[model samples]
Target: MGEHVRAGNLDIWTEQVGRGPEVLLVGGLGDTVESWQFQLDGLADRYRLIAFDNRGAGRTPMPDGPVSVEVMADDAAALLGVLGLAPVHVAGFSGGSIISQELALRHPGLVRSLVLQSTWPVMDPYLRSWARFVRRLVEFAPSERAFLEDFFLDIYTARAHNDGTVDQFIEEVLAFPHKQAPRDTQRFLDAFIDHDTTDRLPGITAPTLVLAGGLDPTARPELCRSVADRIPGARFEILEGEAHQPFQEIPETWNSRVDAFWRELAPVT
Candidate 1:
């Protein structure tokens, strides 16, 4: 069973999984906790997993206000307080990475090791273009599914390598809480588009693992490298032949890499 939380004035919804040290998994723009399907099972085997829907997404209950990634990070910290867990390992992807970076920088005691995949800590050309692309789709597209079908072709490497995955992704997208609410989707997108934490990266103290796809159109490897370079002693790696969704593109490799990072950080028995 799960419930809602009140972080000062902000509201949030969070779910906990497995048991050990807590591992918080944050989703990207308008994505639900279901997006972390790749990391859930494997990570659950080794540690507690706390996956939460960001404010204005899922069942978090946002009544419409300015939503900043830093404000969302505050929600994450509040969620952990409600859960009674501290200094947990945190993992985030894409839009989620923005929150993760803020969480570590602003609430250093609330984060242990970090896994940042297919993302950067700051805004870039990719984020700006996609914000317009999605807005245009909502405004002028003849068919929403057709719009996503084309959009995926450009962002996700899996579309070309495994067409079967797109069907599942579409289903997953539909299941998201804001899927049918354009205003809510736009708010989430706005928060993502405004995400720029370049000046804040030097404050991130958690040991970090930043992964990027060699061909990812959105969060390129160079951007990921910039994140790693900023974080003290953070490790950066690129998975060959993968794009925005490496965990989905090469599950075995992606899971293993994440598992290894968590294990390496865990205290010895």
Candidate 2:
């Protein structure tokens, strides 16, 4: 079962399962614990997996005013500390990847290893253009559902659309129990625009695995490679046919890749 815990000044909603080495899953913009549901059975068998809703997402109450990547990272660290699950293997997706980078840079001792998927370290022109387009969609869309439908088009691949996966995902979103406040959604969108951790990559000391989808349009594979190059000893790989959210599109491969990385770091018992 999931429960609310006091993390810093916010009541953060979190869920955990399985046992063994801890793995913390941080999700992207508007992603809740449900976003990581596909990994539960695969990863939970060998690790205690924890997933939480970031501030401005899902059940977590958003902080007032503007937010930053550092602020979100602090929230993740605070949540783990309060639950006595620090120094965990941190896996992040998209916006969560940005926060994960900040978490490692600011609280190195709290992160045992890092898995960054569909990530980029800098908000270059291509990304900034998308950010602006997202802002406009959020601001002008007639309704929440309308905004989501339009937004998903840019994130998923053509194959997902052809196979009805996009439709299924939209249904999932529409049926999700907790809805994020529009204002909170905007806060997260704005924070993503300002997030840039390129200069800070060298500070991370964790064993890092950077995964990118060859078909992912948002965080292109080459940009992800740039991130890998900046971090000392970090390895980068591209899932040829996968898109931005590979875990959802190709769970088996995503699970195996992530599990392999963690297993390598596990001590022989």
Candidate 3:
């Protein structure tokens, strides 16, 4: 079921499925709860999976002024607190992974375990350029089709693009009712660029899993490795041939890896 939780001034839209230990799923900058459709059922059977749209996306409208990764993390923590779901497992991707880092840092008691996928602890020249270029493209693109065409290349692998999966993705994106505004996207992109948790990884108490795609251009292998290296005992896994959207590209592998991590820590009693 889906409902709105008042996270301070924002009315964050949240969804829950199944019934067990809670697993919170945080998505990318402009992603909504639907972004985790592939993992919802797969993880829900074993964990009460909770997914929500961040502030300024989907049902949550952007508030005035600038926002930061810390704000977004606080929003997630607030939602969990309101729903009585502290110390839950958290899995986040791309921008969401950045927020997850902040969540683990600021609300350590609320996270039971962590999964950071296709994310970086610090934004460097390469990632900064990509974020800037994407913002410019979204602002000046003549049409949504042109934007999606350009975007599909960056997020999907060459094989997936050639195999028609990219086409389906474009269609799904076009079908969404609440498309992210270009300005809002730029704001979130800025948050992603400004976020740096490299110095704080050691403070995390949760068991951590960092998953990266060998072929991903966005969150490159070295970037993910650095994030994992900072967290004590954090395990890093590489999914060869997959790109930025590994969960979507290889659902079984993504879901199974996360499930195994969670199971080992707190098996069903």
| TM-scores vs. true structure, each candidate | 0.90, 0.97, 0.98
* lDDT for 19 (candidate 1): 71
TM-score winner between candidates 1 and 3: 3
How far off is residue 129 in model 2, in Å? Answer: 0.8
lDDT: worst 10-residue window of model 1: 174-183
Say which candidate scores most in lDDT. 3
Sort by lDDT, top down from the best = 3, 2, 1
For candidate 3, write residues 33-129 as lDDT tens digits.
9989998877777788999999888888889976999999999999988888889999999999999999999999999999999989888899889
Q: Rank the candidates by TM-score, best first.
A: 3, 2, 1
TM-score of 3: 0.98
Whole-model alpha-carbon lDDT for candidate 1: 0.78
Estimate, for each residue in 102-183, the C-alpha lDDT of model 1 and write its tens digit: 8898899999888898777666776688677786776666776776777687567755537677777776675554553567
Least accurate stretch of 10 residues (summed lDDT) in model 2? 260-269
**lDDT tens digits, residues 1-269, model 2?**
88899988999999999888999999998899999999877778778999999987888888776598889999999988998977899999999999999999999999999999989988788988997888788879998789988898878888998899998888999898798877777778788886778888988999999999998888899889989999999999999988899999888889988888888998513
